[model samples]
Target: MIVAILGAGPAGMSCANACLSFGLKPVVIERGDHLGGAQRSNFHPNLWMLGFPGETGEQMTTRLAAHYRELPVTTHYRAEVTRVAASGDGFLLTLAGAEGVRTLSVQAIVLATGTRPRATPALERFAAECPRAIIGPLSDSIRDDIRDTDVLILGGGDNALDHALFLAERGNRAVVCTRARFSARKPFIATCRARGDIELREHCARPELGHGNERVTAAWANEQRAFDWLLVMYGYLPNTDVLAAFDPAIRPALSAGGYLHVDAWQRSGVPGIYAAGDITDTPQPSVPTAMAQGLTAARAAERDLVKS
Candidate 1:
């Protein structure tokens, strides 16, 4: 059986490894030039990844890529699936890359495309016109040059509060504003509260952002503040737009938040299609959980193929 995994992130890599173990041919498709997905930009150590203590995300990527290089799985880097259609109990995928366009047939498909930072229309407009605007914390754009500065963060999720702590450690002051109550972890909320450099605000509507010179001015609810940078950490959205390549009837069900809906085995309710990682509506999105889901999806694909 041939399994086509759409992504080169942790989930896709794990799925490919599992497929090889099951004696299935795995073809991994990646839109990026390399693996690890958003993990590539993570400079902080991933405490959630067991057995790899103190290893940063970049280091972990290098280790994973090294092992993956030894595998026989076929890979397409800097490529994407442009189209997909049902083909006799399987799928026909159209791919476009530097080599131009081509097609492939596979018995099963794994959607591990992952997620991206959520954005609002106002934020998008502001970011386009202001150089001090940043979408998320996991960006190289603000990695080194953004120290000892004042930052304005939007959101109250774990990502927002966690990065507030990171910025504080970097000698920067941060002001966090959320539309609703703080939904971040208790530890994060408490830690941020204990810090004098970080200010947390709830029930804040979208701020009016204006830029001048090297700084930005944010006005919200009768309060005006100036910051060196504006970091919007409104959380993530699953990258399920690839599903548009398939007919509506073939597309898997999606949650209200646009994440794929999957079962215990990672099956997408649609036979021959499975999803893993941030693409699915998992309660907790983490590296280990994505890896486990990918492995399970591959095994489930193998079992169903064998039964057929």
Candidate 2:
């Protein structure tokens, strides 16, 4: 049976691998020039470490792509699936690519479109004027050029603390502005406080950008003040556009935040549709969780297909 996978990231690749192992034909479509989804190099530098020191995101994606190449799945890079519709006991997917639009009829569909970083309202405003204003996931924009600049980070989460520590280690004056009355985690807060180069400001809003025709010059939190680069560590939002063509019964199962609702088997409300990775309503959106979900989805799909 032909199975269409909506992404070529870790989750999609994992699902495709499982499908191929089950003797099913798999088609992997990716919107970007390469796979890895958000794990691409454009994200924050400190990410992909999984709190351990090892391979980078780019390295991991490269390995994933290499592994997939050895599999029987057909991968279409820079291909975007614009529409999905039920057709003749199967499904039809209309894809737009660099060459032209193509259509694929598959028996099963896997939604693994992944997610995009959610920018804070404060940071969005800052970015509107100052081109240098950067967000956590997009931290690579300033990674190489952050040597001597004073960096202002907003949020007290792990992402915020990590970026602050990274900037401090790079010899830049790093300060964290948190809305929480206290740091979210004591250990992280303590470690950041212990770093003389990193300053912590609690119960604060994003500072106002100093007026300049170029980058941000200064920031103000209430009466406190600071300067230079601004990085906001907020989070992410799932990309569910690929599932838009699904029936309404399937759509409502998605969480308020747009994450697909899935059972332990990763089956959504639709019988032949499955979801995996950060696009699900799973409590944890980690890489391991995505991989496990992908495996489960593929196995469930195989089982269901056999029973039918």
Clashing pairs in 1: none
Query: 8-81, model 2: which lDDT tens digit per residue?
Result: 77789899999988878888888887777767663333333365446666666677778878887788888887
Candidate 2 segments whose C-alpha is farther than 4 A from its true place: 42-53, 120-122, 138-141, 181-185, 210-214, 217-226, 247-252
Return the TM-score for each candidate structure. Answer: 0.96, 0.88
Model 1 misplacement above 4 A: none
Weakest ten-residue segment in model 2 by summed lDDT: 42-51
> Model 2: C-alpha RMSD to truth?
2.9
Model 1, span 91-161: residue lDDT tens = 99999997799999999999999998888988988899998898876486556777899999999998899
Model 1: how large is the Cα RMSD against the reference?
1.4
